[model samples]
Target: MKQIHHILILPDRVVVDDQPVTITTQGADIVTELYRRYMNDYPKFFKMDLLSRLGLVAADILLQTEGAERGAERDDRAVVIVNRHASLNNDRAYEATIQPDNYFPSPSLFVYTLPNVVAGEIAIRNHYLGETACYIAAQEDVEPLIASTFNEHTTSVIGGWLDVTDEKEFIAKLSIWTH
Candidate 1:
């Protein structure tokens, strides 16, 4: 049987296993604060989109709290993420760059237009070589989407809802499931 461990990363607080790990009232600063407090060593974080930043931060918190291995390749661990917005935030930014007046599409922003990029970013950061999947679905379908991703080769999974809107509002509810 697989046991699921959960973490909720909100604009004001982060909770793991139903216990608040950190609290702050600042809205947008929570993401950067999480990066600074938990992952200051990864300079690449600054280059990622807001969606990826939220997912990465939530994954880091969930995996660290669960005592999952880090700095090591884990072929048996999979990363699966589902969201309703589907990278709309980055898409809007990229769309703005391609406008007639702006005509300067940013390659950096273009890279994150795909929703799966968030899952890819997390895999690269953690050295997880197992399956990485991202799906765009309704909130109620997220659990099924994540469950369907598991296979015989998968021993553990880091996955959940990672959604960000064009307005910069976001929510990440990640979990680590292990047998």
Candidate 2:
């Protein structure tokens, strides 16, 4: 089942360096609706953590349609590719945390050190228990990452880039591919 595809794209949004992203009213409303639909298991969805909030939004976009929830079994798979340009130095802060001389890592920003955390958030929201990975690149290398996934023969991949800086630009695209 080797194939190439382009998933959904959530345009005009941006993710922050070390904080929860600010979304448009349309984006927020979409997330809220999806949470009400697929997240019935969770009684108090609004009070969920920021991590959960981000994940739900990703899941909502990835799993579009009403019955999409039915396909969101534990066997489904997903991957997240965040854009480096989303922020001025979001990755730089992650690096500084581990630097010996400059221990300037902010605790708030440290939580996002694991790129997969966002993936996990989406996984939890949609109950996708297959496989996931997170990568860091400046830009123009997204194809390499996509090709590597093909080499691994992973199907139904959901990949995109989320960048948050002064401009707040987000490019989250979910591509369901198979090999």
Candidate 3:
């Protein structure tokens, strides 16, 4: 049976190994606080969109320290993330960019309107050049993507429930499954 090696829950909290992280800080600085509390260095984190930011933070918490040293090969790990809003946060922002008043879509903001960008961001951060994909499911849908059951080629999978309704309303519950 596949086992869950680690897990992370966010924007307002961090839970690992089924226990609440007591060392965390809170409020509007949740991500920033968690980044400084758990990560040693990852300056590029600030550049990501809200969705990507949440995904990256969850991935880091799952792959930090001893978990990273496992040295999984480049193609051994796959990233499969699922979200409900499908970058609605970025979508709204992108729409604002192209409005009549603005008349010009911002490239950086336009680029992340796709939901898969969150998965891509995770793959880049963890150096996992394997199968990377994202699924758009309704809040009630349940499809399996976070396991070695993916296909014969993949040995492990990194993914889970990743959703962002907006900056203030979001949750990223991620985990790694090793088969």
Better candidate number, 1 or 2, judged by lDDT = 1
By TM-score, rank the candidates, best first: 1, 3, 2
lDDT of 3 by residue, 1-179 (tens): 35465566665677776878864555336767777777648787777788888788778877762255834548777887887888898899889878887888889888898999988888777777889888887534423546434667788787778888876778877767776
Residues 96-175, model 1: lDDT tens digits? 99999779989999999999998999999999899999888898987777677677998778988888874347788888
**lDDT per prediction?**
0.83, 0.51, 0.74
Question: Candidate 2, residues 50-168: lDDT per residue as tens digits?
Answer: 33344445555445532244543665455656565432334556676768887776765665555566667666666777676666675566656755654434456666554433212
- For candidate 3, what is the TM-score? 0.86
**What order do you get sorting by lDDT, best first?**
1, 3, 2
Q: Would you estimate the TM-scores of all the predictions?
A: 0.93, 0.54, 0.86
Residue pairs whose backbone atoms clash in candidate 2? 7-174, 13-170, 15-164, 81-160, 83-161, 86-163, 86-164
* TM-score preference between candidates 1 and 3, better one: 1
Lowest lDDT 10-residue stretch of candidate 3: 139-148
